[model samples]
Target: VVYQRIGNIPGVRSASIVSGRNFFSGSGSSYGLGFVLLDSFEERDADSLSSEAITQKMFMRTAGIADAKIIFFTPPSVPGFGASDGFEVRLLDRTARDIRDLDQVATEFSGVLSQRPEISYANNSFSTTFPQLMMEVNIPKAKEAGVPVSDILSAMQGYIGGFYAADFSRFGKQFRVFVQSKPEDREEADDLNSIFVRNTQGEMAPISEFVSLERTYGPQTIGRFNLFNNVTLNGGAAPGYSSGDAIRAIQEEAEKLPADYDIAFSGITREEIASAGQAGIIFALSILFVYFFLAAQYESYVLPLAVLLSLPIGVAGAYASISLMGLENNIYFQIALIMLLGLLAKNAILIVEFARQRRQHGLSITEAAVEGARVRLRPILMTSFAFILGLLPLALANGVGAVGNRSIGTGAVGGLLVGTVIGVFVIPVLFIVFQYLQEKVSSKPAVIHSNETKPNV
Candidate 1:
C-alpha cells in the first residue's frame, strides 16, 4: 500500500518495497523497507518539484498509516559512512529498563524531536509489538522429578527454537541438520504440555509440569550501544537547514531526556561531528605555509602580509556567490575556497614581486607600485578570465555529480572574478604600504664622519 501510494506521488519515478535488508538499509531490521526514486533534474526543475519538496508531500500523504512508522531520507552522500544522510542517534538506556518501557521512551523521544523546527522527521524502528511467549522454569520441581534442568531446556529448545543436531559431508559439500517439531505441534501455548524430557532413571516426564508459559509482547530483536540497551533514531534536517543544525538541535533536546538516558551518534553523524571545524584549521595551515613560502622567496618576513591580506576579498566573494546560489558550504565549496586562495595569492605575488624589483632599482614606492600594476595588468586579466571561462561548464553542470561540480566551479569563478578585478587595484596599494614600511624598518641611522668626530672629542 505504501509503495503504491508513494509511487503515485508527483516527481517520484518509482517506489519499491524490498523484502529483506540490504547493505544500505542502515542498522536495523528489514521490515517495511521501501525505496523511492525521484525524477531526474530536468523533470524537477522548479523549487516546488525538488526532492525535498516531493519528500514532504510523500510524508503528508503517508501520514495516515497509523500501523507503521515511515521515514524518508536521502541516501548518504558518501556510502559506508551511514545508512542515510542526516543524523543517526542512539538513545541509550543505562538504567536497564524493561523493553516495553524502552519502547515508550523511544516513541516519546521521536515525538518530541519531530516537533523541533530543525528536524524534518525523527522516528525509531525499535518496537515491542511482536507477539511473544514467556517461559519460567521450576528448577526445584525438575530436580525432584529426576528430570535435569538441562533436559527440560533441551526439550523446549528442540521443539520451539529448533536445535542444531549434527553436520554431514556430501559430494564436496557440507550440510548441517536441525531437529524441530512439526509446525502444528509447536503452534500453540498448550503444545508445551505435549513436550517430554528423559529423566535420570530412564523415565519420561512431561516438561509442562516443570515450566510455565504466558503470552507477552516484545521486540523480535534488541540493540545495544556502549554496553547499554539503546534505540536508534534516524532523521534528516528540515528544509533550509544543514545537517550540523540538525545535530545541534538533537543535542539541545537530549538534555530534556530523563536521567540515565543519553544520546550517541553513529555513522555519518559521528564522522560529521569528528570533522567539524577542521576546515578552519586546515585553511589556517594553508595560509601559514603560503606565508612562509613567500617570505623565503622575497627574503623579507614583512612583505608576505601584503599578499595574504588581499586573500579575503576572493574568499568573501566565493562564499557570497555560493550563498546567493543556494548552495551549502560543503566539501567541494571548501576545496574551491582553497584553490581560490592559491590563485588569488599568485595574482598578488605578480604585482608585489614586480613592485619590489622596481623599488630596488631606485624608483619611489608609489612609482614602483603604479608601474607594477600597469605591467602585470594584461597577464592577470588574461589568466584570470581564462580560468573563469574554463569553469563555466561546471557552474552550469547537470546530471550526475552536478551539485559538487557547480559548487566547485561557481566558487572558483566568483572568487577569481572579484580577486582579479578588485585585487588588481588593491594589490598595488597594499604593496606600496607594506613595501614602504619594510624599507623604513630595514634602514639604518645615518653616521657622522670619524675625522670630524675625533677633533670634537
Candidate 2:
C-alpha cells in the first residue's frame, strides 16, 4: 500500500509491495508460520505468473493441495502476552477473496488488524503459539515455611539454567565451573518441585508449595534489528533492467522510509565482498610471482622492463569488458585483471625471450624479432584458447557465488584474449626497440659459442 501510494504520486513510474514470513526472529521451528501481504497478486508476481497459477503449480508439485493450506497464515500478527484479551484465532476453510474478508475477521475484536495479505494465515502462529507452561508460585505459602523467594528462585535457576560456580585456572588457561542437573532429571516437573531453597532463617523449602504452574500458548519476545521488524523482501527487477540499477532504486526508496526502519544489503553484496577479497590477494601474489619469474628468466633488467610494458594493454581490455558488460569494476574483476597480467606476460615473455636468445646468438635484432613471434604464435594461440575455454562455464555460471565467479572469469578472458593478440604483435616491436638500444651501446654481441670453443685475444 505504501509503495502503491508513493507510485501514484507525480513523477512516480511504478510501485510494488511485498511481505513475507518473519523468519529471522520467529519460533526456531522448521515449519513456523508467516505470510506476505502484496498490494496485488499480479503486481507482485515473482516470475510474472498469476497468483492462482503459481498456487496451483505449487499445490501440484507438492501433490497435496490440502496440506499446502495448512502452512498458510491469514492475520500476520497474533496476540502476544498481555494482549490476548480481545483476540481469538479463527480457522478459515475457504480462501479469502478480498481484503474485506480479512478485515471483517480481524476487526471482530478491538485493536485488531488483519495480517498482512502476503503471509500464509495458517503458518503465522506456529512459532508465536508454542505451548508453554507458566506457573506462579505462592510466595506467601513459602514464607510460612520460613523459605525466602530468592532461595526458591535461585534453586530453580540452578537446576534449570545451570550456575557458574568458579573458574578453574590451569597452565595459562581458565575453564568455567559449570553445574547443572542431568537433562533427563531436569525435564521432569516433579524434579522442579523437589528443588530445595534455603531461607534467611536457614530453613529449606520445596518449590511446589511456593508456586503455581499453568500451561498455555504465547509468543516469545519479538526482537528487532535496527527497529522496523526486519524481513527479507525478495523480488527481481523488470526485464531489461540491470540488477544494480534496480537495487539502487529500491535502496533509495527504502532510505526515504522512517529512520526507525533498517534494511541490509545482503546476498550478493556479502558474496562479492568475500570473493573480491580472496581474488585480490591471489592476483597480487600471482603478479609478484610473475615479476620474479621474469626477472630471473632475463638476466638483463632492461629486457624485463620491455616485456612488462605489455601489461597495460591487458588492463585496458579488462576495464573495457566490464564497462561493456555493465558490470561494476569490482574486486573479482580486478583480481582477474591481475591474473590476466601473468597470462598476458607469458606470451610476451616467450616472444621476447626467444628474440633475446637469437640476438645473443649473433642474429640481427630485426630478424630475431620477426622470427620469434612467428615461431611462438602457435603456442600463444593454443594457450589463449585453452584459458578462454576453461573460463567459459565460470563466466556463465548462475549458481551461488556465480556472480563473483563470472566477474573474474569474464574479466580474465577479456584481458587474456586482447592481451594475447596485442602481445603477439606488440612485444615483438618492443623487443626490436630494446634490442636496437642494446646494439647501439654494445661494442660486441654476447655470442653463445660451443662450450669447447676458445676465444681469441
lDDT digits (tens) for residues 1-457 of candidate 2: 3333233332224433333334323333223332323344334434334332343333334344343222211221122311111112222213323333333332331111122221111122322354666868686787788777777777777887789999989999999998888888867677766677777787766677687678886544432233323222333322233334444554444444433333454445334334545765776677667667776876554567667788889888887876777565655777687678878887888898888888777788889998899999999999899989999887876534555788898898888888888878888999988767656765446788767778888
* Lowest lDDT 10-residue stretch of candidate 2: 81-90
Model 1: per-residue lDDT, tens digit, 315-387? 9999889888877777899999999999999999999998887777667789989999999999999999999
Which candidate achieves the best TM-score against the true structure? Answer: 1
**Candidate 2: stretches off by over 4 Å:** 1-23, 26-147, 151-284, 327-339, 361-364, 398-401, 436-444, 447-457
The parts of candidate 1 lying over 4 Å away from their true place are: 18-30, 37-50, 97-104, 128-130, 163-185, 193-195, 201-206, 444-457
Each model's lDDT: 0.86, 0.58
On lDDT, the candidate that comes out on top is 1
